[model samples]
Target chain A: MTRLELLAPMTGRVVPMEEVPDPVFSEKMLGDGLAIEPSEGLAVAPMAGSLVVFHSAGHAFAIEGPESVSVLVHLGLETVSLKGAGFERLAEVGDTVAAGQPIVKMDLAAIAAAGLRSISPIVLPQLDEGWRISKTNAATVQAGRDVLITIER
Target chain B: MQVKAQAYLEALGGPANIKDIEGCITRLRMTLIDPSKIDVRKLQAAGMVGRPMIIGKGVQVVVGTYAELIGAEINKILKQK
Candidate 1:
């Protein structure tokens, strides 16, 4: 059965990427993805797949895994507008990025000194139309870590 | 609704400097400086439109496809800056 899978978008602790509910305020929050600063190291493809979307700034990407999982990487929220000013594009659209391949290298100091965080967001684009995503306990994830919810299609 | 929306935008540092906004399935992604200062409730209460969800110890706001629209609004706002 083709199942859904997640791969590490960055090289860092594969902590369970989850949403935090501020019970006091009664709200929920999204994980910043693998929280690692730019250039602490390079973010790699968790798995080899087709590059579905690549932002112009070269900070984020999406991939449809071999198992039919869609993943998104928001490198730095507003950084996209930087227009590749502080980031270097390591891969091009339609290019097959290999797992653990070097996609882009960032200048962490410049980003932080400029008051930006290196924490990026890697997400499963959708919950397959007719299916519910099943998951195990959230674990610390590193680049290439298998931390994903399988869509039972 | 107008008043509530303003309150949230203010908490998010107002409609100023907001260059873009977008989200994944569970987040109302905001791109701004010192993201640490975001008052999600203020933004939510201000009627930005979206539900806040808690997944994996993080906060997310639902903006739907309008997320891109909000982002464009932000971009337009940035042009003046």
Candidate 2:
């Protein structure tokens, strides 16, 4: 089976989702993946796909690609209350995005001042049967450069 | 001081209007019974930083870092009745 690699959507330190703190994500209720303690203010598309779900708040988004693989990019822990103050949307729903294309711009300083952690969780919500997902061991990842997820179908 | 989650919930038309609640690092994501019921003035008064967004069947409220705590509180309220 050929392995499909999903690159990092943002630059940050990659941590296991189990460290996310929020039970929903930590327990893999939303799906299994890794989290990033982001250092930059921008998030890009990890893979070329069409945006299936785009929140107006720019806090979270879900993209669906071929082979029934869907990925969710959630910014911060509880930043939904920031109400898009520090977030900027670069793409809209149904837009076709290329891998490494900027999709959201954020003010990390502003988010920190608001007392929100800028830890982002990138999850694969749609894992079909017989598909295996694995995480890369890279401690720090660069957007469009490092492959954080490897999938074998 | 930022508005308490309880106050925000009250201004959001109570738990009855809430269909579901989820939180990310900086926001309180919710599914509301009626998006029109949201009072922007009250939300701002309660210390929300930005405008609310209605996405599909859900609404997202920017709650900063305390979003998870607030989410937990909301869940507690939901369980009560």
Candidate 3:
């Protein structure tokens, strides 16, 4: 299995990600990835890959890149209803992205007053492979921070 | 806050049984292990209150916050075999 390099969604605090179970771990609990306080200002690529699973709402996307890595980004609550009204899609499906590449942007505060969460989740689907991947601290991250998640096969 | 849900990767007869696992508008869409071990009643019991929905060929659990944790645990459990 090839190693998939993952990156932190934001330069936020790198605390130990809790191992939650059942109803507590669902998307609904986070209120559509809220508390992370999303923004219409900008949602950049945490890594390079095919931009798959861009919700019609334009608030979320699932990116697939090298090593079969899948990264899902949910922008805000019900922001999908905006229907791409606020966010600007920087790239199209199957397009390759690089670390720190700009994908979308908008106002952060405005997104929350509207009643939504900003907690973004960076996930790895094929994380089951027998490889060694290490993640850094989930500190308050910026777009271009060197938050490397290297998976060694 | 607090959450709970039932997770399965082995019930599908190991990860080999699943073609893919993804989430949608509400439910976590899963391509299953023969779709035989997918007992809605049993899955629901594991989830406490949230019921399981058969969306298309995928058997889904209404995992809220427990979604990620359940997923994490499933991944760990599956990797052990």
Candidate 4:
């Protein structure tokens, strides 16, 4: 079995997805994953892979993950409407990114003042069957730290 | 604001073009069939906070706090049509 690591994209307390206010995320409609009560606004790649979906809106970006899993990193609630106003894209679409590499820098204060929640969800929308996903319970994690999600294949 | 949201969806290729709808705090994340059908200028004129993008066969629109509501509205509009 191969073990893959999903790194922490930002420095934050890892919360169960249920802690996320939105049903879509909290309920795991998007897929099984954890939510981060972000202390910083910098979003990074959780695994080294191609940048498959980089929304210009800056609210979200998805990295094609290792082992064919796709990871969607959504920053804040409705922060997309800010239109990149407070987000600085460090990487472009189709670019290859490494785990924990800085991909987007966000203005946390601007996002909060705009009345948006900064809870970021790191989701595996296309999690494959037979792959086991495990997470660390309610802990503060640093960006680029190894394996927030330990995947057993 | 809801009316504007509807209009914005219409501008972005309508509900029929939408394949899947989900939302984050401030954006209505959707997978659409065609990205070319979107009218970015109209959405901008309507005071949309951000430009829509075609990401991995999906369209993400920044609709602020009303994102979830708009996602529901898109479904309703799709059902109606």
Candidate 5:
């Protein structure tokens, strides 16, 4: 069995994915995961892997690690409509990233000013029947240092 | 298993119902002419990851990382017709 630990992509209060306002995330439509009401604007890589999917809008990106495990970090709810206005891409797709390396820098104030929720969802978009996932119990987590999600397969 | 774009288009009420469609990382965001015509069961059968969501004339199908490819495929089919 392979075990993968996903670090918190940003410092924030960790909440269950169900609390995200958007049904796409709260309903766990994409996959089971957690959300964070970010207290900072910087998002980091959740694991050591090659950056695979980085949205042009800079609202989301995914990293593929050992065992083909992928973790997606979405900056905020409906931020995609912003079309990269308040987001800055720090890392490009295909770049090898380590857990905690900065990926995108978001302007939280601007996002909120645009009337969008800044609660970010960290999801495992791909999972198999043999995989098991565990979420962190901590109310608040530090980026790159705290284990946010654990996956085993 | 990757879902065939043709299957997704059919599940979404075919190319005629789709007014606009785009990929947003993990989901296909679409504006349909008749949102009610979307078949959730058909979408599931087409390998959708979770329940498809409808908000007014807009429908979102969570197709994970392959959303871009699927959206492009659907668009190609729409252009052909």
Candidate 6:
């Protein structure tokens, strides 16, 4: 069995996935993971892998890391309606990235001004059978520096 | 995956019931002509992870990262009709 570690995509208070406003995320519909009420505007690669999915609206992105574990970082709640207005993409889809590398930058103030919540959900999207995940107990975490999730197979 | 898409389409009340469908990273969001026509049981059988969230005329199906592919497939089926 092997284990994979995922770092926080942005600095923020780590909250249980259930705390995310979206039912899809809060209910773990997509997969099990956590959310971060980001205090910083920058989002980084949680682990080294190919940048697989980068939403055109800039509200979300996913990275496929080792052990075939894919981590999705969704920027905010209902921010997709903003249509990329408060986001800047620093990396393109298919780009090979390293852990902690900056992939996107957000204008948190703009999101707030638009009356959107900036609570970002970090999701597994898909969890294969036999794989288990654990989250950090820390109330807050630093982007790319703190471990957010650990997966074991 | 195409088969799953077809199942998802049927679960969403088929092409005639769909007004628009788009995929975000984790879910397929659709606007349906008749939200009441959606078959929640079929959606769960077709691999939908969570309950189909229906808000007014809009419905969101959480299909993980395959959301885009499934959305495109459903759109293709819609186009063919």
Judged by TM-score, which candidate is best?
6
Q: On a 0 to 1 TM-score scale, where does candidate 4 land against the true structure?
A: 0.68
TM-score for chain A as predicted in candidate 4: 0.95
What TM-score, to 2 decimals, does candidate 3 have?
0.55
TM-score of chain A of 3: 0.70
Q: Across residues A1-153, which tens digit of lDDT does each residue of candidate 2 receive?
A: 756778899899999999998655686655689999999989999888888767667888877877878888888877777878999999998999888889998899999999989999898874777888889999999988899998887
Rank by TM-score, highest first. 6, 5, 2, 4, 3, 1
Residue pairs in clash, model 5: none
Stretches of candidate 3 exceeding 4 Å from the true structure: A1-3, A11-40, A77-85, B1-81
* Deviation from native of the Cα of residue A93 in model 3, angstroms: 1.5
Model 3: per-residue Cα lDDT over B1-81, one tens digit each: 112222345333456666556444234557774666665655554542355555556776554323444554555554655
lDDT, candidate 4, B1-81, per-residue tens: 568667877787877787877655446777778889888887776545546756678877665344555666667767787
Q: Score the docking of each candidate (DockQ).
A: 0.08, 0.07, 0.07, 0.06, 0.64, 0.63
Q: Please report the candidate that would top lDDT against the real structure.
A: 6
Task: Mark the 10 consecutive residues where model 5 chain A has the least summed lDDT.
Answer: A22-31
Local accuracy of candidate 4 as per-residue lDDT tens digits, A82-113: 87788999999899998889999888899888
Per-candidate clash tally: 25, 20, 54, 4, 0, 0
Which tens-of-lDDT digit does each residue in A1-153 have in candidate 1? 555455556655433344212221112122122333233546667567877666556666666666565666666545655666677777876777776666676666666776765666555544345655555354444565544344556
Candidate 6 lDDT by residue in tens digits, A77-151: 988789889999999999999999999999999999999999999999777889888889999999999999998
> How accurate locally is residue A124 in candidate 1, as Cα lDDT from 0 to 100?
55
User: What is candidate 5's lDDT per residue for B1-81, written digit by digit as tens?
Assistant: 224888898998987899999888778999999988989899888878777777899888888776766787788878889
Q: Rank candidates by lDDT, best first.
A: 6, 5, 2, 4, 1, 3
Question: Model-by-model lDDT, in order?
Answer: 0.52, 0.81, 0.52, 0.77, 0.88, 0.90
TM-scores of the candidates in the order shown: 0.53, 0.68, 0.55, 0.68, 0.90, 0.91
Provide the interface RMSD of candidate 5 in angstroms, 1 decimal place. 1.7
DockQ of candidate 6 against the true complex: 0.63
Please identify model 5 stretches exceeding 4 Å from their true place.
B1-3
